[model samples]
Target: MSNILRIATFNVHKGLSTFNARFSLHDQRELLRKLHADIVFLQEVQDEHAKHSKRFSPFPLNGQLEFLADAVWPNYSYGKNSVYPAGHHGNAVLSKFPIINTENRDISAHSVEQRGMLHCEISIPGWDQTLHCICVHLGLFARWRTKQLQEVKRFIEDHVPADSPLIIAGDFNDWSLNAGRSFAESLHLREVFEHSHGKPAQSFPSWLPILRLDRIYTRGFSIRHVEVHTGPTWLKVSDHAVLTATLAHQTA
Candidate 1:
């Protein structure tokens, strides 16, 4: 039984070219497929509106989530939060295992920005218990994010099993916010990137990286390895750097 699972979290910037002119969903799909993460959590997944994307460039026919997942990833789910004249966008999850249950929670705290979380329960091959995967996207304001984080905590407490293997990852927009710590501490979640690489995860401008906004966290899994995925292909993929981790389940 190949229980060796790898998970990754990335904010795809809506499959755009890091504020550049390039707008090809296929490129984003290729980038993510190359990673081959067992469970992939993504923020800024565009669902529709070719008119807006066409202005930038012609993208693929499938929605951003489907496009990114492509045929490589067998299972996926989308949690829509933000809506605009251009279209609606949100978070998404892609997994290789059989997904047993799924839900999308709206945690938007203000009208200015929309955010959401996607929860998916997957059945792993070797594990006696199922895997819980969460995809999160927080707001811009600190106060609003705090409230959202509280809701997120409650959601976890109500839905997820405390004794099961858990993974929560995505964009926190923690430019100067403590929401990550506020909710994470209460649940005893340890960040993968920060634990392995450090606090600063150069992920903003893609090229320069000014903010530590993205993260991968887990409690029931023992992290054996972690990386920031900052190679040549990564530098051109998305504004936020993708964080990946290989977890060895804590055998009781």
Candidate 2:
């Protein structure tokens, strides 16, 4: 039997519409369910927001991660990256499989931009080895992103087993498009859209996407299909388009 997995990466903009025009967490949760992803990598998810809780009518009392993962994805992990008086926000991974282990690493290049990588080891049914998943949100500046990428590489090299099935996905903020080359050369990971379309999918400014800021990179899988979800409905959900990929596990 072949094991095919469908995964998605999205930057949810802290569950708010563009320009903070409105609170869209409810709509975002519905959209996530529609994706039907087996694993989801999310960035800019609000773990808590004291002010928003009072302002937004249907704000989740628990947190964005729990609200989004409600019932659909039974297993989830979050990495709190940025914290302020208002509350905290970060990256998260939601999976259908059992998540056995989770770790959050701070890779902030400066005090202003608090960034992190959320790593999870998931146990897929009938699989002999655990799958490694990393959810990341890089810094805005190119220099900071470069440093963060190195940190991610080091983290993987030190922790993940050499032969494990691995996936790293989220908002890279890499407008210059150099991160793909770095990942390919350093980690032998292939960006799904780049492998299929010869370039990364343009996923920024969801209304009319023209910049490749989001990505899904993987190892030990054969890319079957990849898509960028962008339309009027999606635009109302977030500023970045959702990137989804289908892969067939390559058995040893």
Candidate 3:
């Protein structure tokens, strides 16, 4: 029985939706397989739409989430949020372990922006417990994001068990920094990336990495190892870099 839990979070930019290239899910499967995480939280995943598929090529005929999951994580769940003429896009959780419960919560307090948090309760072998994993993607504006964060807090309080190991991660879009820390403290959750390292990783704008937006956070887990996957392989995958971590439950 393996007690070590490997988790990773990434904003896949709708499978690298580059208007110019329009390759369509190109390299996403390959890239994710390389990460080899036990559980994965993905932001900006598309379901299916031939129009959009044609517009993007490497993966045109398959549901974006299914395609990626089939190749990488076989057992997974996706929560659709923003539905537009382009297609429906949202968050997804892929797990190698048994998923006992799952829900997709709408955290978009602002009607103007579409956002979501995909929560999944997974039963890992050897952990002797279930873990609450929430995959989040917040709004663009600070005010809207703040309200959304509060909503997220309420959601967690109402749904997730307090005693269960809690992991909330994804593209927070909080380049400013303070907001994330404030929210984490309020929820009694620890930001694993920041605790292990010095700060949240610079993940957005994968080309330049100006903003420290993407993060992997765990509230009840003791941080073991934290890694930000950068360099050439990541640059071709998405607009945001991936955050990976190895964690242990806080000991008594």
Candidate 4:
């Protein structure tokens, strides 16, 4: 077996244009299809939107996660973090392999800014250990993010095996790079872009990305390639560009 995996993380901004001028879930789905990632971690995924459901003629009855997954990714999990009378939005993970277990943990620092982590244990046919993928969307404030990071650390220590192949990805919203050191030290994981290029990729404000607010971190894998999508097609899809990486599983 190749022992190679292509993964991507994207914050879809709830499938809207820069200022909610347009709805582009259909276009976004097409772009995701082209990535052909083995696994995809998504933030700001809309689980339900009563207004949108009625406004958009083609809105999927199931959910945005299901619509995006379509027929390609057979296994998908969603975590509803923020809920309102209109609808709810959160994180999601779509996998080509079988997802044996899934959990959504609420790690919100405060009730005002809801947040959660979507964890999935995927069974790769020939792999010795299960692949643990966590889709995270942290808070915007530095103080809240600090506490959320701690929660994430505890989640790993309590559930994921230390030596397993693990991927932690999504919109970190840590523009100052404040959490990088702590995460790397505690998780023993490396951010794909930083590991590959000595610096994290600028992924916010897709049209002219100049903020590193998104990330893809991995443990027990060697980064083969990494990049940020910032072209016109990406800009039209969401406010935050997609971060992609190819990881090679390290031998024991």
lDDT of residue 161 for candidate 2: 94
lDDT on C-alpha atoms for all candidate structures: 0.80, 0.91, 0.80, 0.90
Clashes of each: 0, 0, 3, 0
- Residue 151, model 2: Cα distance from true site in angstroms: 0.7
Please write out the lDDT profile of model 3 over residues 1-252, one tens digit for every residue. Answer: 655788899888877633324343657677778878989999988786557666554555758887887855667989988988767999999998888889998888778888998889898777756889989999889997899888888988998777878888889999998789899888888777678677888776765577899878787777888888776445556777778999877644
What does the lDDT come to for candidate 3?
0.80
lDDT of 1 at 41: 91
Per-residue lDDT of candidate 4, residues 107-136 (tens digit): 999988999999999998889999999999
What does each candidate score in C-alpha RMSD? 1.9, 1.0, 1.9, 1.0
lDDT string, candidate 2, 1-252, tens digits: 248999999999999987788898898889889999999999999989999999998888898899999999999999999999999999999999999999999999999899999999999987778899999999999899999999999999999998999999999989898865786679989999999999999998898899999988899999999999997666567898889999988888
Please provide, for model 1 over 1-252, each residue's C-alpha lDDT reduced to its tens digit, 9 standing for 90 to 100: 665788888888877766645664567677677777888998988888758556754565677777677777889898888888878999989988888899998898987788888899999887888899989998888888898888888988998889988998889888763677667789998887666765635566666667888877888877788877664454456777777889888856
TM-score of candidate 1 against the unseen true structure: 0.92
Instruction: Give residue 43's lDDT in candidate 2 (0 to 100).
Output: 96
User: What TM-score number comes out for model 2?
Assistant: 0.98
Worst 10 residues of 4 by lDDT: 228-237
How close to the true structure is residue 131 of candidate 4, measured as C-alpha lDDT? 95
Question: What TM-scores do the predictions have?
Answer: 0.92, 0.98, 0.93, 0.97
Clashes of 4: 0
Give the RMSD in angstroms, all C-alphas superposed, for model 1.
1.9
